[model samples]
Target: MKTYFALIFSLFIAATAFAQNDTTQKIVEGRKNSPDQEKKPYVILISADGFRYDYAEKYKATHLLALSSSGVSASSMIPSYPSVTFPNHYTLVTGLYPSHTGLVNNSFFDRNLKESYSMGNKTKVADPKWYGGTPLWVLAEQQHLLAASFYWVASEAPIKDTRPTYYYIYNDKISIHNRIEAVVAWLKLPAESRPHFITFYLPQVDHAGHLYGPDAPETEKQVHFVDSAVYELTKAVTTTGLNVNYVFVSDHGMTKIDREHTISKPAAIDTSKFIVSGDDILVQLYAKDRKDIQETYQQLKKEAVDYKVYLKENMPTNLHYGTSDDWHNRIGDILLIPNWPKVFNMYGRKQLNPGTHGFDPYAVMDMHATFYAWGPAFKSHLKIPEFQNVNIYPLITAILGLNYTEKIDGTKQLAQEVLK
Candidate 1:
């Protein structure tokens, strides 16, 4: 009887131990399959510069259309006021307007730095002081995710004192095929070294749009070329067997401009009294003295009949400009915005491009850009109405599951309808 009881107790202990080990193994597997422990999702943001919203409809871009059919698309992506390149690109990444980003235009004078920042000025372009708000890549790195960029605006700059995990300085000479291959190679990196967020920029579309009118055959050819490149990139990424969420966007669209509609500076206004910035569509006049402010405003108001002039404090509320002191210092004492197809000149002008942007976003359909997203995270066959470009930053962060606490103007609500 004693031997029987001892044997039974030993058997009970063995059974309990086996059950506990089985439960432990199940818990480990559960954690391994948890949403947080699974392979992290990847996001690839591609920008085909000057890719107007209508291009997908007008051109033979079967790839883009197919992607749109499979994912979410917007009728148009409304650009921030000034509807230019650098400002809108930075806005898309930082979720801040040009006024807040301190990149009011493609080229602006930094009063504090006492230096001019132009697209052509490589040194100044790489300087971090010129950029404001936290860039997407910098935010990603802070959360232990890696980021990479290829020829993105302000990507070369060490924004917020940190650069992307991998980046390339702007190099127009690099062929599109080479750029695509480089991106593929980056994607093929070891899982430990791979980047979670990647940015690719293609400027050929914008260049073609500037050299020729938006509807010209040359522009159409370039658009097709861009489409083909994008298709190749998608194919390459798919071959890697990695799940990637792709987002295609453009900074702004191009509008036809004519040489016949030129508005030169009025002779009454002294050129030396103020410094002016901006191109034909928008002119920013900075008075040298406080007294010249009213004079410049009155002169521009009286002489420039084709353009609308406004004092800095009285800028249009819809523009979301002139509120920040940093932007105010960069802007002019008097703002001049021309009517459609009209050009304003501060100096003797040369031949202008057949197409250009920087028009008021609300007034011109041509100023609207493109937005399309495709991936597991997005709903298929979803079409959303046009929303501000500022909202893209929040949508991207949300998709990456990043914790963002900045006071950004963007909201995920603008893009929530497209998410699964």
Candidate 2:
């Protein structure tokens, strides 16, 4: 009886030690996979343009909701100032606000370059010379990790002196599902060349939101469709049993700007004198031909009350915008910010709906976007109330275990919750 009791007591002590070690081991593993934990970790960053936080709760988004429930979530992710698509999206990868990033407005003229940058075409879309600073994909390559982009601006920029290990040029014909298919295919590549970093951009939501308000049934349908695509991608990847980190985000929310209160062209200045960048809400006033800058400045200033006007030299300082040599290359000569309940539309565009973005980011309309993270590297059911989309750079850099030198505009790593 004495021997039996001694043996049982010994067994209990051994089991307790193992249990304690098990808990510690999980923590150690968690830390090992944290964003800053590894130098070459697999990661995926998805941009569902115009995705709103409320939509997540209002709609049946099993995949996205699962990601939020199992990982981290925020009520809304605010965008940088001048919350247009390209600028906000660029901010995400570069970790800099639009003002600092030089994408101040959606459509602006490059005085030095003698051209304009718009969302259309390869020349405007893929020009590396126009882009500034280092992006996430370029940084990933520096650290020896393969980075890939399905179709995001500046993705094809020749800044890095070499292309991503795997990349696809922007093609509108490629359906959202096809893009996700390509991403999954890349993930299944041979282990030696499998992409460790990936960024996916979906235009469906943004398109629908632009055509219809966020609450419109068509836009709601688009939200569901993209959510389903996300589900398919997530399901496919997890089935492979490969460890991965994922983040779903948006550059900015959509607001239905009222189409009234437009500023008419001054009769004093020839309407043909300037090449307008945007129609009504935002307009880049540029010289259509050589014109007197002083005279033009005065004409615009005299009529400023009708609009929120800013000369290149006097754009709102709060925006962190400036007309530096590089910026002047992309900054318009003058900017017109229309008042509330009013939107701008250029006279020539064939846009069916008269709605658009390219306005202040602080307004209630443009402030909210989306931010959520999931996978093996995140804390479950965590909520980060305040975070910037720009922080996404550092987060992705950490996930892929790469070194990013740029002082990130938003660099707060979701580190606390990510560790066990």
Task: Assess every candidate by TM-score.
Answer: 0.89, 0.81
Name the lDDT of candidate 2.
0.69
How large an RMSD does model 2 have? Answer: 18.7
List the candidate 1 regions with Cα displacement exceeding 4 Å: 1-38, 324-328
Task: Report the C-alpha displacement of residue 45, candidate 1, in angstroms.
Answer: 0.5
lDDT for residue 153 in candidate 1, whole number 0-100: 88
Q: Write the per-residue lDDT of candidate 2 for residues 152-226, one digit (tens) a residue.
A: 667766775645666666656566666667777777766656677888888888888888876688888989988
Q: Mind sharing the TM-score for model 2?
A: 0.81
Which window of 10 residues has the lowest lDDT sum in candidate 2?
23-32
| Cα-based RMSD of candidate 1 | 18.5
Residue 327 error, candidate 1, Å? 4.8
